[model samples]
Target: MGGFHRFYPNACDLRSLPVQEVDESVSVQEGQRLLQSGLLGGILLRVDDVYQVILSSDLAGEEGNQPLKTKAWRPALFIHARMPVAELLEQWMKTPDAVPVVADEHGVPQGVIDPLTSAGVLHHEFTRIRSYLDSILAQVNECICGIDDRHKVVIWNSKAEELYGYKAEEVLSKRIENFFSNLRITNCMHENKELKGHYHQPTEGTHVLISAAPVTHGSAVIGGISVEKDITEVVQLNQELTRASSQVKLLEQEIKKMSGQECAFRHLTGRSAVMQELIRFGKKVSTTDATVLLRGESGTGKELFARAIHQNSNRYMHPFIVVNCGAIPNNLFESELFGYEGGAFTGADRKGKPGMFELANEGTLFLDEVGEMPVEMQVKLLRVLQEGSFYRVGGSEPVQVNVRVLAATHRDLEAMISRRQFREDLYYRLNVVSLEIAPLRERREDIPELVHLFVQEFCQKYGKSITKIEPAVMTSFLDYSWPGNVRELKNAVERLVVLTEGETITEQSLPENLRRNTYISLVTTPAAQGNLMNVAVEAEKQLILKTLQQVKGNRSEAARVLGIPRSTLYYKLRQLGIPAKG
Candidate 1:
């Protein structure tokens, strides 16, 4: 036991030299010493007058070994120690709701690393971290919170409570949907897979930011961890930062998504017009023998669309194979895509296994990032298309494929053709039926619907309810440009869902990046003149109106503040559609 640590054995011992008694509970410190001792057989101590001791399986298994009693999780007692080990074991025995701990090689019992301690050290650490976070949040002056696995409100920070008119205690055990009013919070979470900088909640006029990570145990997911912050005011001050982050990244990840080659279109999420259109097109082209091409931005669900196309085609009943032509190393492209016969290569498969084409006969074959295919492979593919045949290395038999082809890529084939990097002839062949997917920003109207689907999905996934969004949130969602496209939007929506403390989402639930500042475009040309003037007047009018409202409709005071006559102030207010407060 001492081998794992630096502790050395004492020169002299008080009790019996080596071996002794049976089952009994001993004091904790004393039992530790006995286990630390070099020589010992069995020890015992009476715990609450009940004698019990744990026996080593090694000794018990021996033909003439001693038999001893044992408990599953609790430490065993050795009867040979000077003091009864039973007394030590009894100290922690029958303790209600104790967490299990594994013993190290040296018999050191411990659980997670400093996570559950309530000692001052842990308390201080948590406090320091919280304080630093709070300071940063305060500098931005935002409201933030997060949720647990069941979607319960685990982190209703002071600011959140202050803005929502609820105490942390009142909101702690409840799920976010229980108190929220907007439905968009769930939607935003679904889009981004993370809540960006600041977001709004279901509570009107309040905004927040939320982030989360999942916690897993074995094959099951125990729960998740999340963080939140409110930055409505701060974002308004610096609207240039409206781009928020994704929730998937914010939350702790138990499993990695790996890469596209490792996944058959995993990480894809969509159910909008863009998604439906691709499916409809796939169905149309898949039934026929025509080759299909899927074009979209990177991470815009192209591979997923390709896989779906193959699955629904006439080849659905057969082996639907996928090949990432771009991912195959240039040197190994031929061997990997076109398998070798026995002795074809230095270390070819002795059985002469067929290439992807042979395996995909009478089925659907998907080519991802086909633009990345080497020119040599392009000619080979052209041969297969022109004549339903290809030769396996060292084999004379030409393999015929009744296979349908579906190819997808993020690159512009026309641009690649201009560069002469991709084969124009092959592009024309594959482009018999092309499906172009619109980016997320192009179809902003579909966002609301898409967000809802994700929220509902995540609710069932995390065993949580769908929280809502604030009214002001959509203004930002619509205003911000999603460069990462629908995929990024989906991630944000998921983040918002986990961060919420209520059912309704609000502007407060929208991420900071979603509510970024409006850039002042300088357009001096006559065509853009009207646009710039209108924007300016609108801003000035709103500024005056907001200032007037702040003073509670004091027209005289507003006029004085604006350095204008009361009549002029009233006229301008009427023109801007700003109503007077009673």
Candidate 2:
């Protein structure tokens, strides 16, 4: 027994304990006498193949004459010999006064557990479990804080100390509200609810993703636990990134301004001397609020220049509304310029609509082909321009606006005014700062640049790869007078790029008019120094000779090709002193 006690301080099982085995024929009085002698721990009575435990304390004053089987032994809990120490201790602890009987696999009683040893084992196991829980709380990465029902801090893990700068010794057992006045852990416990992935700012310049839950034992609130992840560095980084982005944008805007690629006018391009001068002058004009009148031939990019002016102006950020006076019907002119109210007329907008002036408020209003406006409407337009206000079609209330007017036209407004077809006062009012845009022929140097620009533009659009234009084609382009101006030239280039089969544009791919013009330019270049009549005769003679040569000296075919009567061709042959035979 001394050897067993040294090897296993807390007895692992009852196998080595003292026991008294007796037959059921033994009288209960004899069983009690033997147990009271204190030589054994318990008495096991055997009847046939079964055994039952009878403790001496259970039969204290009963000296019955009946057999031990008839003794008054209360029901006992039987534990297996192989039962773990924790389980044995738990069973003994539940009914502390009842000594449990230990048995083997075959229902044979071994012995009874010692009450003193079982109590010691229970305390040892509880200490081991507590140490394990403390180790887990100390090593986890997330901040852990726990509070009891009294709102006192019960658990503060190592991570909590690192994040909140409060040691466990300093915070434990203290009211949590004293440390974090706005903590949601208290709210979680009060509401008896759980919070998952909640963002919180516990202190200034600190951010965290926190989760909290109330600890409950059988529907009764006992405490609460909260876990948090510190995200202060991440939040600071994001704020710094936003400021850096804003600074980069500001730098980019400043660079564009220094390089003359200002936001709105960057797309307008021209390098010719006349165009450069006009652009410079227009840029100066764009700084003021005075009315601007753009004058040019039809298709001379009048509207484009007007847009560039507006874009360069102070009102570039606002809208630039264009109203084509020639395109609007005379009857709808007033309503279109000055919008109508709701139910003003049949088919009008039900909620009313703003007109060009209202839409162009704080911006530029470009009245294209302004000469085409009816004389009556001209008076109303002049009045609005003078007063900066106008009444809607159906409403009597005057609508005031601050719009800069830009008028464009290809007609001679002075001539129309002289004929009384246009209002003279209106013409003068619109011509405050007249800007004459030169036709494409007058600024012929810009044609090549415009041509290449259009070529690159159309190549990408039509999926073509025409890289170069034949020298002859470029020469013809230079000589041809573009009556339709830049707009016409752009269309012609688009057509050529689309129709040309190969990677180069040649004279054959040009339109019929362009080809004919090229031939006339070829013949007229040498005689350009001669008198007007001499140059004209030389051009005519070269045309006739080239046609006759094409048909191998057939005069009738030559005359037919020239679109002239055969007799007139012969008379011109004698008149120009050409050989009649060939």
Candidate 3:
């Protein structure tokens, strides 16, 4: 039995100790190679049975006094094992000076390297190959199911887990055909031939692609692996594109269904359940002249709905005028809608053209940003709805043109009514037929549909053939709090379609603010906040209080730390019922 002194040299003469850098990039194999090279001495670098590296512990010099690296050596070997290396090391710590050996009969190495290196060769594999598998499995958004000749799952990746609504363990030995109502081909179990390639199923929204490879062991055919990839999204997308393409062709056929040569609704595609409800409502309300108050966040296609309503009404052929109440100047409001005579005011037209209200005679007029309409004009609007008569700016003659009113606003007019900014009478009059359109956030479940519509329309409109938003981009799009609402989303899609120059929109193509973190601000800051002042104040109070604990209890410093005025800070504390200092 050779002791440390035997491994070194000269019994009590010190020296003959090998020192090495612990953090060198040398792996276990390299370390073992060095040890087997017969350098100077054999010193195993392992923890228990598992060896990380085996180095030569030969040291230079000899004398009565010992070198620090030689004498101060409390050497131990560490190993990277299948189980926790540190745990294995802790278990076999027999003695302080005991050297861990692989076998008791003789010293021989078991496995002492990376688990992967132990399995495969050092072939040219991409560094991210593992990550790629993880990602493919992760991004396998389309739920997939894998089965064999017996219809038993040989591979149950995470996506299969998500798609089929089955846990991996639960479905591993089970048949995949049990879950799906329509498993396209029954030859999936045919022992004669294997199948390959994708199969598209319309209306069902499921694409079943089967690729089969025979399993052979000892040169005999046992069974086969069948990979089923669900491509419903891809099929739906293709259908949308096909629909958009055949619009003109289908228009002729669809027009024959209705009596009037003039169609009442223009085309905008939406097939999702919510949009279907909207479409149904649109068709139902279009035949009437009732005052429609369209309410939704900005960009939610209120104006589009309004147009559709007018086109479907009794006055389909009449002019449909659109006016943004917020965009028009306060001074020009009366003339913009009611129109002025030759010399009504300073820059009147010689012949005089009618306002949006007159232009929309016998048809429908869409009033956008109705929330921003001045309280002063609310009286004139009420007069029109009540008596159905209005005078031009300079003319005393009441215009007798019959018209329908459809007003829309992104703001909460009810809330505005409570604040005394909006007229309650006008609210009741305009809200004759109220349609509350939900924001994109509340309807996140409809993102796939919305994205499908927007991506298809915008790409075709902008001459960009981008088919889909990348998985990451779609994730970010769903996560982002679109304050500007659907309008913002459309603009983002347009921007991505134009700028990305690819078949898909990526997260990078979106605005900097949008491609960020998702957790909707639990607390709102004063800046970047909307009319929800009370919510913002409460949120700011919560954020300040939570951050205050980091510095213990220092109000003056806390205010400075919070980036708010000390006086303002005190006021906040008083408002929140939180005591200051004492």
Candidate 4:
């Protein structure tokens, strides 16, 4: 016991006692007697020079009989007295029920650490550390899966159980590949590589994004850890957004259709049979990809019809480009139509520029006054129409384009073809569908409606109001031949609205060529002076003739304009010896 005190001075000093030893041959009865006398809480049993701990509880008997040998005593944990006191205390704290035997360098028992007293401080610190770690792991939202080097699952967090539908007890220590074949953890361990944003579909309708990393110690990969985020809701939301976008596009198309029907064709208005038929045909051609040739006078609204057709087509979302063939210079026609390369000419742009055809790709191209294109350029235009490809100026490569061509011309293409002024091949190509707008003179019945429409339009533009037109002014409009067609009529009405001061437009406010008396006399020949009755009768005859002509020989319209009954007009026509029908 003195040698034991020399070996572990501090442990002996703390208890203020010397070491106690028991022989291996001592019976459990003797050991209980020592404990009852309060001489020892535990004792060391010597085996040669080594020592083992024997707790006082080991002396208990099953039925009042003691064990014969120490072989029946449970194994004891030993510590060297030369070790630090703090380490010795920690060992006792981990196993509070087991006694620790402190031995010397020669393995002789030096002291014993009473489990009840040494474990109190260490137990409190160990419990606090364990609680902190468990709380942190429990609060994690991402599923955590960890695997050892042997490919067995070691850590399965609560989030993992919720996400993968498996409990920790069921999967721990099991082979990970048996449950999930393509887990990133297995791949990361085998490849020793970090994977990020890896997508995996474990089951139907279950999508997860996984980020995994190799667990390494001292530059050696020993295990793998992976974090999984459930992305099923995100995937579902993206699919729904795609479907909603498609529905919105369809609704926009329907709205454009209704708008086209209501106002896109407002420029092509008339009640004449020929004009009605032209409008119906134009509407039909608007839905097709066919080339359209609009033939009419300059102011006949051919360009307006072209725009309406484009607005009603499927390519309405793309650009609608207009190129005036007659307006572009003959020298720059080819370059303007087909684009140019960098430094193609002395004054060309350094970066080059896309021409009308390229600009109008996937869209409509309106070539107004197409008959004005030179004969040489007509061949190039025909090639683009036939092949859907063309070469830029000074460029070796041919550019491809998808474009719909809509051509308008006031010139007589057939007559020009005869004189070789226009290419017959190009003419045949352009005239896939032809529409001819009737001159305004030929549709005289539409004049009043056009005048009213123009009045409303110009009034809004100039911020003025003129709602009424005198009967004499309207009669002059019906009788005059509008050589410039609807455009000319529009200009005349706009002038009246802007320049007239009165709320009503009268004959005094009319232009020189559109006066009532002048138009009536122009349609009838002058007669010599005569008696009052004769002069009055002559004037009435001239007025009736002019009104009949103005209404395109419609007797009902004629009587309406003249403010006479149809029956009275018929009787007067018979008395004047004039035919009622033209």
- Candidates in order have lDDT scores of 0.58, 0.81, 0.62, 0.78
Model 2 Cα lDDT, one tens digit per residue, 275-328? 888887888888789899999999988888888888777787689999999999
Give the Å error, residue 86, model 4.
Answer: 78
Q: Where is model 2 poorest over a 10-residue stretch in terms of lDDT?
A: 1-10
2 against 4, candidate with superior lDDT:
2
Candidate 1 weakest ten by summed lDDT? 7-16
Candidate order by decreasing lDDT: 2, 4, 3, 1
Candidate that beats the other on lDDT, 1 or 2, i.e. the better one: 2
Model 3: per-residue lDDT, tens digit, 307-375? 878767777667888999999999989998898888887788888878988888888888999999998
Say which candidate scores most in lDDT. 2
lDDT of 4 by residue, 500-525 (tens): 88677767878998875454554454
**Runs in model 2 lying further than 4 Å from the true structure:** 1-266, 527-582
TM-score of 4: 0.50
Per-residue alpha-carbon lDDT of model 1 for 128-236, expressed as tens digits?
Answer: 7677756754554334555555667666666666666898889887887788755343444344343444344555655556654444544455444445566557766
Error of 3 at 314 (Å): 1.7
Score candidate 1 by lDDT. Answer: 0.58
Between the candidate structures 3 and 4, which one is better when assessed by TM-score? Answer: 4
- Residue 11 error, candidate 3, Å: 99
Candidate 2 lDDT (Cα, 0 to 1): 0.81
